[model samples]
Target: MNSNSQAIKLFLVVAFSCTSLLASLTPVLAKPTPNRFDAKTILAQAKTFNQPPIPSGSPPKIRLRGGGKRAFNQPPIPAGSPPGGRVRGGAKRGEPACPTPKIDLTALVPFTQEANSVINVWGQTTVEHPSWFFYVPYTKDSPYTVEFVLQDPDANEVYKKAIALSDKPGVIRVSLPSTTPGLAVDKQYRWFFTINCDKQKNSPPSFVEGVIKRVNLSQPTLKEIETAEPLKRYAIYAQNGIWYEALTTLAELREKNPQDPTLKAEWRNLLSSIRLDDVAEEPILPGTP
Candidate 1:
């Protein structure tokens, strides 16, 4: 081969190798994203799972905060305050605002490995800090204190706050503030929703705990949700098994369109799918978390 020809061939070989290397590295860093589940496909599927493709067809066990196995048999919201606390949301005339028992503190999640009369559930998220929900059976006037704690995978404290809950009972949500540290993607996080009924605050408080894993969504998938109709976002989130955002999106929609019959039915169906039918018909109380 001529000198010029040989040099040209060498340069071409080097260029091809660099291209191949980049191609290989690209996939390693860029994980595969989920395909957009459009309205047609979502409608075709009658049920939306807490999370689909669960290995055992059941939810994975929730990660307990502080690795403690302590169980609170007492009601999360102890019943002691006066029975009459000014019925605000048309609560029944005779219904006990604070029941002696039958505490119905529930975490709004699908995957639950155990419920020892309290709650333990887990799910995934695509955002830094996602919102969590619960079905509170007590009114804001009820005698109780609320505390929410978030911990990282290493069990390190990330954010902790004592929330002041108001408004009539039903469903409520807690979202980490903008200043709170964002959850790292791929790392697991654990949270505790403890309602301290004891005046001491040191007693073993009844709580609902859940685990969360932050995942990444592809650019296209992100774009679709951001640009699509506001209500459509909920369906897409549900189809992808993103419980946190799905529930939040649905809740917000319900707040704006309380009379939306379709949303009302969907709210029931989503809760029913996870066997939370007891609080299925409960109102999504309007308020900031």
Candidate 2:
């Protein structure tokens, strides 16, 4: 073959070899890696945990509760009310005087539907001492008495804690203390977050309650969680149907790294997944014991 023809043949071979090599590596190099925790992919993987759907077996364990009025000590709903019974909503925190910040007290929880009459939401956790989060619009300038209560399935009280919000308006967390009894596995416990808006003597306070069950993590799932980095630990939890852990981990991460845009985007995506878009933008405060 002439020198020119030989050079042309060699160039063709080199080009074809490189193309084949790239084709072989496409899946490994270009495919999305689990550790990436991209907003779309991580949130899409979140389908594995769809905000703890409204369960079918029993009536909703969570509800707006307290004595209906100043004199009533019992829950407002009569005994044996229907499946979707109306629970009592305590006094509303009237419009405060200064600059009007967010006026509603909100729980950082997954809800089946929103209303003062009823609340239907349940989140699962693998840990015994799980932390509950909320957005408290009332600052020290416009404070409210907040209390946390945990109850057994029989409507009996388990642990009662009082929270003091002495800071600015923002999100706050209430952690089940080590002194309190750790949650029993597979048993649903009811918890109430109450804000006494008026602080009236013998008056019922505004409260929202939810049911949380502790479950044993599978061996393989536990291994995955132990090895996951901070960027993906929350995603791992969410993929396995652990709602409290998923939300808490991500919220803690976002609180610690406030300036990271990637974390912010991931936070928004996670909250928006379950229709909790309203309280997504509130600032997270340092949690209490």
Candidate 3:
């Protein structure tokens, strides 16, 4: 090889090595930015955007005016029912009102009970005056035996009697008589009657209250029968086509001589003839003397 060529080659190698070394040692230049962001300002902005710190594990506290307790003692609530139910008012418990008594005439009369003589108006002692007669309608279906009870203002029973009712329909006349010969009248003597009927079919133990009425017997009157008279004698009897002076005359004859069929016929006839109006009519006035 020539000396000039060897020198040229050595120069080229050295130059290439120098150029590679310069390239390796050279610094890299960055591109210029339009706007700059400050670290301090960025840190402040991040702190503002961050979520608030979580609360501690505890319930919030609240203050009340009054203590924590109910105002009233509530009643026990029924299960599956509405609360505080049903406020109402009415009649007190265990109290029953008085019921009005009604009379049933279709039932049967009692034959066993006897009449009381203490309340007899025609007999010695009476409850009412002779002029006035308290009447009970005799029902053909049932014979009712009424017991008369005399009561004072205190509701105490002083006198009572069970009078057998007549079979036929007629007034069971009660004639009131004066207890004293002469005196002013006082409070009305109150007498009530109770009807005792035999145990009837399909009916409860039946009875009636306040059957008889009241009268002031002490009141003065013109008609005074000071003498005792039988109720049958005073009872006006209507028989046949004519009204008779007495009821028991036929009954008396039948009783005295039971062997006679005529007497029985006479009694039946008299009973059939007894008309209500015939007994009600006042006696005819005597002609002017």
Candidate 4:
């Protein structure tokens, strides 16, 4: 062979080898496998966001005597008085709100790990009206009336609804109706959920209450939420401190896919992060009234 021919052959051989090497790695590079979802990692990232501060003192205990109908429009428990006050239970202020002897009621409010029954949810400023979630633990399999009441910062009654729950003990989600008036931006509202156990006496109602505020979301945030994948959207909400939406989205997803172990784990992790491990294992039932 001539020198030039040999040189050309050598160059071709080198080029062919390089091409084969790249071809072998093409699948591994081009079709990269996605990382498995890590509940702890995602939760850690979420904790980096600015969450509302948990109240310092214990919640107040308000024991209901007789069938007296205290006005629902009363001003919220004074800020320095107590964080969350129980209606009847002798538990000190800042204690869990739904400490029913038989059942426990919990609001799906963020930053509640240290809070009593009263939780404060940091919402998006642009969101007019938002939904809320509750974890109700019932010892018996009987029908119970769940009452939801919303009061404005001025303690004015804004919305009220009574839902009849027939499902067995589990976590229930409550979405404010779009038809209802939207929450004003930069405003705080107090919400109360009571499980009317004794209808005839109406003395003590198993109840949980929390405060929610509406804040504005930046355009980039809105875009991210709109474009993010369904599974990842909740994490985004959590990282941004959008409590109501995060809990609601994960819950709705879990309800639709009851058998998804990943969703179940995510749900448990989400609740556990808030110190609600007790009710974390409860089933996510379909349809909330």
Clashes of each: 0, 0, 4, 14
Cα lDDT listed for each candidate: 0.66, 0.65, 0.31, 0.62
Top-lDDT candidate index: 1
Summed over model 2, clashes come to: 0
Tell how far residue 7 is off in model 1, in angstroms: 99
- Candidate 2 lDDT over 28-112, as tens digits, reads 9999766767788778767645444444333233211122210101112212322231122234454323233444666666555
Over 4 Å off, model 3: 1-134, 139-144, 175-185, 198-289
lDDT for model 4, on a 0 to 1 scale?
A: 0.62
Pitting candidate 1 against candidate 2, the one with the higher TM-score is 2
* Best model per TM-score: 2
Model 4 worst lDDT window (10 residues): 65-74
TM-score of each: 0.63, 0.64, 0.25, 0.62
Stronger candidate by lDDT (1 vs 2): 1
User: Residue 198 of model 4: what lDDT?
Assistant: 52
Candidate 1 at 42: error in angstroms?
33
> For candidate 3, what is the TM-score?
0.25
Residues 184-222 of candidate 3 have per-residue lDDT tens digits of 133223344444343342222233222122223232321
The digit string of per-residue lDDT tens for model 1 on 1-289 reads 9999999999999999999999999987787766567777676563434333333323433221122221111111112321111101112233323344343777787643222322335666888879988777666686788888999978899999887766766788889888998989877777877776667644555566767778787888899899878667776676666778878888988899999987887788677666666777988877747
Q: Candidate 1 at residue 207, lDDT?
A: 62
As for candidate 2, its clashing pairs are: none
